[model samples]
Target: MKILITGGAGFVGSALAIALKQNYPHYQVLALDNLKRRGSELNLSRLKAAGVEFTHGDIRSKEDFDALPAVDAVIEASAEPSVLAGLDGTPDYLINTNLFGTVNCLNYALKHKANFIFLSTSRVYPIKTIETLNFVEEATRFALSDEQPVPGVSAKGIAENFPLDGARSLYGTTKLASELLIQEYNEFYGLRTVINRCGVLTGPWQMGKVDQGVMVLWIAKHYFQQQLGYFGYGGTGKQIRDMLHVADLYRLIDWQLHHLDQVNGEILNVGGGLESSASLQELTQVCQEVTGHTIPIKAVAETRTADIRLYVTDNTKVTNLTGWKPEIGIRRIVEDITAWLAENEKDLAPILK
Candidate 1:
């Protein structure tokens, strides 16, 4: 069976492709990417080395999908993964890629009778709702107490059934909108599909930026001894987030692909869950532990308008369905990134800077 991974050269996509090739060498895995993301080009070499075929194509263009061979499965992993995406300017690129891009991918999926797997974002939960959740700020992070059960959250974190009503930011809206579209295709057209509303995914080869990829960015900043900043929410650096290593994501995807029949047409919250959750303050401690370097950090009371103080995936639904759980914790994530950077420092330092 051949699998097509959109955003194939991306951190998640590439990692999935490599794992597929290694575990199931007999099966063909092709990676289709626009290579538009700045650091995605670097993965071209890695993809080649993994024996995963690479094609340069954008999901925004229908022609790209039409030109590709029909595959049994398509993992729509492409996105403009930043909450502050459109806040800085027009959300054209984010809209075009995350929204229209999914349409194009779904169209391709329907045409081929292929299974569609969408890597949606945890940000799809409304910002107003998330920010309003009851919180207990500790020395390092904000957490939900057991007393008040948040509408969309629990001690397990944000679940799939959580309220999605308010403004979830433009980047989130696009993914949520795409999830709706994927559902339509599944119900109306009988296309087999699974939607994973994922939280912050990290690991090696992730080109983490300021607005997105906070985990990797934090690790890199500390390892390189670069300056970092904490913004908003009193700038205590206590805002929290759960993280999933991209490798753990790949394992879950593999399970979903093999069990498409049992899990079709379901939306699941997938992430590191409570065990892998961390606040920026806690992350700072982990980075220092991993890199043995104190990162220079500045703080400000003014925060990004679209930023959420905390988010963690409940992952209960997916776990019940597939027995999939994030195997790596925050320390392991930092350690992995730390090792990756140390090995590829000569080549990665410039882009990271």
Candidate 2:
């Protein structure tokens, strides 16, 4: 089996490629990315060393799409991922990358008769109610629906069944639009497709920016001793998020692709679930434990727009179907990231944008 993964040089894409190569050697993995972002080259090198084929291209280019090798599956990982940055750029770029880019990839995959899996985000849900969920403040974080558990949803976090309609920012609007496109495509083309609305995804090679990958940013700040700001620190710096190891995420994708016939047009929430949720203060402690550094951080007066104060996915659907679970915990994630950074410190400085 051959697979084409867009944004293969990225943190999650590259890790997915490596995981695929290790687990399924018979499967040829081809990764395509524009390599426009910092640390992507290093990510590409990591994948190349793992024996995966690397291709340089943009997902928006028709020539690039036409150039890809025939494959049984296409994992659409490419995106302008920042929910915050979408506000600055023209709606055209947002439409092109988040909306049309996905349309183009789905078209390509359908033309080739390939299964598709999109790396969607939890931001597609409304943030107003999320921030307003009933919660009791803990020493470090907040707890939700404390009175009654809502089966798969309340116990786990945000379930796939959550309404997509509340007030959404520009980023969520674009993703929500694209997700509808994929759902429609699956119905029209009989193409097997699943939208995995992932939570915070972080691993060793992640190039975290101010707008995305907050967990890695936390670790990166400690690793570099860089100046850091805490947005919701007054709330105990306890904004919780379910962060998953990209390797485990690849396993879930592999399971879905192999069992596409069993499920079609399913919008699944993918993440570490409640088990992977962590607060900023907890993460800072992890950083302190990992780096042995009592890092100093400044607190920002306000939180960003569309910020989910405490939202985690209820990944019961995925676990029930695939029997896939995250093997690495948060502590392990911090340790692994610290170790990887320590070994690759010299190379890391160049990639810090």
Candidate 3:
């Protein structure tokens, strides 16, 4: 089987490419990326060493896909993933990449008759709805109350059926719009597709920042002894998020590829679930324990317009269908990142710090 992963040089895309090639030596895995992310170029060497072919290309241009050979599947992983992407009043790049880029990838898949898998975001759920969910503030974190005002949400987390009426962020609107387009493609073009509405995905190789990849950003700050902050919810650091190790995501994608007929046209919520969730305050404790560094974290009571108080994936539907659950816990995830940073300290210090 042959696979094309858009944004293949990125942390998630590159990791998936390497894992697929390593597990299926005979399979051809090609990674096409523009290397727009700060640390993405670093993965080119890794991809080459893993016997994965790398192509320099942008998803925004249809001509870029023309240069690549036909494949059995396309994993649409490229995106301007920041939630605060267009708040600066410039949204052209984000819209073109996340929406139009996805259309280009879909066209490529359509031409090749390839299976499509979209990496959608939990942010597609409206922030207004999520922020209003009932929660209890514990000493360290905010816990979702069992009784929510909305359906498809519970103490376990938000599920796929959560209402999508309100406005998500600009970043999320693009993804949600892409999801709709993919569905249309599947219905009209007979395309086999699977959509994974993923929550915070973190592991090694992620170039995390404050706007996204917060799990890794938190660890990076502690590992590098950088000052951190609790920005919202009265600055108590109680906002909660569940994060999945990227490896776990790879496992699900692998299963979906093998069973596309079963999962096609299915939109599943994927994440670490409640068991793997942590609040920023809890994350700080873990980071301190892992890095053995104690740093003062500033408190800012003001919340970002795009920020949500809590988001945990309700993975029940996916787990029930595929029997797949995240094996790596929050602590293990932190430990793995710490180890990655330590081993690559010389190379990563400038980038991560």
- Displacement of residue 83 (Cα, Å) in model 3 is 0.4
Per-residue error at 133 for model 2, in Å?
1.4
Ranking by lDDT: 3, 1, 2
10 residues in a row with least lDDT, candidate 2: 146-155
Worst 10 residues of 3 by lDDT: 343-352
Rate residue 198 of model 1 by lDDT: 88
The digit string of per-residue lDDT tens for model 2 on 1-353 reads 89998889988888888889998888999999888777788886688788899998887777888878789999999887887756765777667778888888998999899999899988888877576566667887766664432333474587887766587778778788889999999998888898888888888888777788777778878888877777853635877888898877877888887898766788878888778878887889889888888777888757776676787878888777667778778999999888888888898866552
Q: Which candidate achieves the best lDDT against the true structure?
A: 3
1-353 in candidate 1: lDDT tens per residue?
88999999988999999999999989899999988778899899988998999999999999988789989999999888888888877999999999999999999989999999999998889888887787787878899865554565776688888887889889999999999999999999999999999899999999989888888889999988889999999889999889999989999999999999889999999999889999899899989988999967899989788888888888888988998899999998999999999999988898886
TM-score of each: 0.98, 0.94, 0.99
Q: Any runs in candidate 3 off by more than 4 Å, and if so which?
A: none
Winner by TM-score: 3
For each candidate in turn, give its C-alpha RMSD to the true structure in angstroms: 1.1, 2.1, 0.7
Which ten-residue region of model 1 has the weakest summed lDDT?
Answer: 145-154
Ranking by TM-score: 3, 1, 2
Error of 2 at 256 (Å): 1.7
RMSD of 2: 2.1
